[model samples]
Target: MADPQDRRPAGAAEVLERLGRLSLRELSMESLLQTVADLATTVLPGDLEASVSLLVRGSPTTVASTGQLAVDLDERQYERGHGPCLHAARTGELTMIADARTDDRWPDYTPRAAERGALSSLSVPLDIDVDEQVSGALNIYA
Candidate 1:
């Protein structure tokens, strides 16, 4: 009998192989960013903005994004140096803005998010490096 993971599908097998390889060595940062953005757009169940941001030398920077809203928000955070995701990256915690219009954080960025039709968002830190130094973040928005 074929292994379930091997029998899933051609693309699935390829992805699994890639992930397995990733686990053994340092992942190409660009490849990882692209993979997450592609998953956000095609695999995820909902219509929401998605992003991947990396912490380089103690600074957060957006590496990839799936939607305009998310890209803009990430840019805002990068430019202004503030946002829920930024805070989350710093503390290595999940962060959410249930309703950006009412959220007190990101005084400048929230309005821009609202103007762009983003109502809420969730941000989670991704484990990339040892010691969990908040290598990056995954964000979902609606």
Candidate 2:
């Protein structure tokens, strides 16, 4: 049974400490990453969602997500072949959409994302080893 008590840490440092102390021996990579995605929402101050996008064999995939909205949006971008997540993943640069409905960039994606209630978003590229042959980004939507 899951614990009823909500004991999430209150600050970024505490969260980082908790994450560092978490046991990974029994946790699958997906579970640990999902926890990171969930923790991102707690660390950021807003009503937002987060997801992890990974590029494997030149195909983008959502490896972890806080909610269906995050996963769905990632999938939408994946199917269309472009979006903040993919851009960040490929370029290892930060991608931010201040106003999805008005953003000139990603003309096809931003508007539809706004229609779905995503007013803004930030995509931060993750640092996976080049030797590993994988690239990814942490996408947050608000």
Candidate 3:
């Protein structure tokens, strides 16, 4: 069988166009998050894994993920209460780890992520209005 990653869209434009066609307002939050995760994996470089982490009932949860690896990585961060995705969701800032194994910031998270085959990661905050009780981060792992 062919590698599934090889079938993803080759360019950001294609991903963007696909996303733009979605009726976001009509979709449930779960569906929207799944679409975002799918687009992230398709648009981003490398053999990427993608997930969306969101605060549900004041607890962080992986709302949607491209693969089990993404969900597992997010769970690790949630358990530790720190990681690129959690930091981004809480601070509304972008966090990029060029190499998780060598990143000293999250001594707990990096090694686990590296062990899971995630060499690098990027986490970007999702802009939800203040009235919305949801804080989210788009996490891409490679």
lDDT of 2: 0.85
C-alpha lDDT of residue 70 in model 1: 79
Task: After the best TM-score superposition of candidate 3, give how far the Cα of residue 35 lies from its true spot, in angstroms.
Answer: 0.9
lDDT string for model 2 (1-142, tens) is: 1121332436988789879987899788778878888777777766678899999867889999887889999999999999999999988899999999889888889888999889999999987867647889999999
Q: How does each model score on lDDT?
A: 0.71, 0.85, 0.85
- Displacement of residue 95 (Cα, Å) in model 1 is 0.3
- Which ten-residue region of model 2 has the weakest summed lDDT? 1-10
Q: Give me the runs in candidate 2 sitting further than 4 Å from their true place.
A: 1-9
All candidates' TM-scores?
A: 0.72, 0.89, 0.90
Per-residue alpha-carbon lDDT of candidate 1 for residues 1-142, written as tens digits (9 for 90 to 100): 1222332223555555655655425557676675666554443344576788888767787777765677788878888887877877777799988998899778898888888888888888776778765477888777
Q: List ranges where model 3 is wrong by over 4 Å.
A: 1-6
Please, what are the lDDT tens digits per residue for candidate 3 over residues 1-142? 1244574555878877888899967999889889888877766556878899997545899989888898999999999989999999888899999998799999999999999899999998997758557788999999
Candidate with better TM-score, 1 vs 2: 2
Show pairs that collide, candidate 2: none
